[model samples]
Target: MSWMTLSLTLIFVFIPLLLSKTLNLGLERDTIVAALRSTVQLIAVGFVLKFVFDSEHAVFIMLMVLLMIVAAVQNARHKGKAIKGITWKLFVTFVVIEVLTQTVLLGLHIVPATAQYIISLSGMVIGNSMVLAILFINRFTAEVETHRDESELILSLGGTPKQSINRQLMKSIQASMIPTIESQKTIGLVQLPGMMSGQIIAGADPVQAVQFQLLVVFLLLSTAAMTSVLLGFLSYRSLFTERMQLMKIDVE
Candidate 1:
């Protein structure tokens, strides 16, 4: 029996029970719904990836990046609606981080100048940073609400809005980065991370795949850290008014 067939069969057979167990952790319908949605989405994406990889058209790649941006922006907005302009903050942050990471990797001759590589690289940054945005924005908004009095105190005491919110913004950025930073520390010892494991299972050389996964982890760390800080900074500004007064940082 082929390993691929067995793996695929087990994936289907096991995921639902796995999801049902995860749902037992008080997520209610979340794990079941999310697993189902992911199954469908990944199947659709597999075909889309086939097309994106087949052609090197600049327009097609640009569209894929745009879709990524849209996803990130929407996620940010959903998380940070209280302060407003979270989408714009995330959009700007991604534009800067994604372009810089993609450009530098190409410029440094680290990655092949291929459409698939570029798309995967950009998608990795965009996708992973979405996780950071989700964490930071929600916590930032929650922290703002939790410490509203402290924030207002600063504003009332002649502190500029930036000065008032500086600490909170920093904390949010720090919180967003901790998971990625910790995961990297635990990669080989604590777990076989998804990418390297997948590559090795798919017949790639183990050593080479480990190296590639290391490179990928570093890329994600850089991108997500930078994006978290930048978006946190920008989103904090949106929590203030034109006169440097703190606006209601309440989550909408």
Candidate 2:
């Protein structure tokens, strides 16, 4: 698409802004800021990705992946800041997700170990993991708050921290994973995924695009499961005291 065509896409943005104004939803400023930031950030990322792809240096590729993990951690940490050491927890979760996924993909020769494929897949894995982390933490915090008395009663009855929080933790993990699972159930029938649709628009064979999209779908399923389970396990421990008592968590 030309610059002019891209500029014309602002019509889509304006539609939301107009609705927000008419309905007095008070989202105009946020809508405008998000649109501007997305445009600027994506353009900057496009240039950086081009340079990294052209260089094909392992150092540059690793650096790009590191940046993604750092950014993902930063964005996800806020949702769980009430839990101690949430920043590092998110960092570790994203790194593990990246390492585990790449190991399987590259070890089996499922995809080329090139900057293009590695970075693209890393972006998807890290992004999805970050969202899952946020969802899990949000729900987990709410659960803890709601069940504080029950948890304390369990602790008073000599139950371990893990036993006390097991129900809430499992519920949070399952809740966070539901969206990813449900979306996959209706993927092709309800809508075409962006990656597959983009490839088809770029004149790639439909069969090839579908195959690639399926790979991504499978990768995302693993990403969602690992992210929720790992982050939940890592975070739940922080909600307790060394004395096996439930610590008070103030959730915002």
Candidate 3:
């Protein structure tokens, strides 16, 4: 795409800005910042990825993946700050998701060991994991806060921390995963996913594009489940005191 084509895309950004201003949503500045940030970040990443794709060094690929995970963890941690030590919890969950997904992809020979394939697929896994982590954290925190009395009652009745929060745990995990599950139900019929659309626009076979998009969809399903369950288990304990009493964090 040329500069002219890129300029045309700004109309989409302008629509958001116009709506924010007319509605008095006070989001015009944020909308502008997000558009500018996305442009700069994508362009910078394009250059960096071009170099890494050319290098094809295993070390560089590993480093890039690590950086992506760190960034993802940091972003997810924002929603989890009420839980102590949330960063490490998110980090571990993301790493596990990343490794497990990539292992299956590579082991099954579904994708080759190339920089482009690895980086693009890793981004998908990391991105999904990060969002799931944020969802889980936000929902979990809200559930605990809303049910603090019930939790404390359970504790007073001699229940363990896990037992006290078991319902909230399950509910939060289910809530966090709903978006992924629902989206997959209508994926091909309702939407052409990014990978598939890009491939088709680049003149690839529609059949081939569908196959790859299916791979990504399946990977996302796995990611959604793994991230929610793992992070839910790992972070829930931090919500309780050493005496198994409910520890409340101030809700925003």
After aligning candidate 3 to the native by TM-score, how far in Å is the CA of 242 from where it should be? 1.3
Candidate ranking under lDDT, highest first, comes to 2, 3, 1
TM-score of every candidate relative to the true structure: 0.86, 0.96, 0.94
Tens digit of per-residue lDDT, candidate 1, span 1-252: 465764576566457667767777555367557767886898788788788888888888889898988877886677677767666777888889888898899899998888788887788889898888888888888777778788889888998877787778778888889999998888899999787898888999999998888889999989768977887777777777798766665564
lDDT of each: 0.80, 0.94, 0.91
Which residue pairs collide in model 2, if any?
A: none
Model 3 lDDT, full chain set: 0.91
- In model 3, the runs with Cα more than 4 Å from the true position are 17-28
Off by over 4 Å in 2: none
In model 1, state the lDDT of residue 252: 48
Name the best candidate (by TM-score).
2
Output the lDDT of residue 62, model 2: 99
| Candidate 1 structure, TM-score to reference | 0.86
| Weakest 10 consecutive residues of candidate 2 by summed lDDT | 243-252
Against the true structure, whose lDDT is highest?
Answer: 2
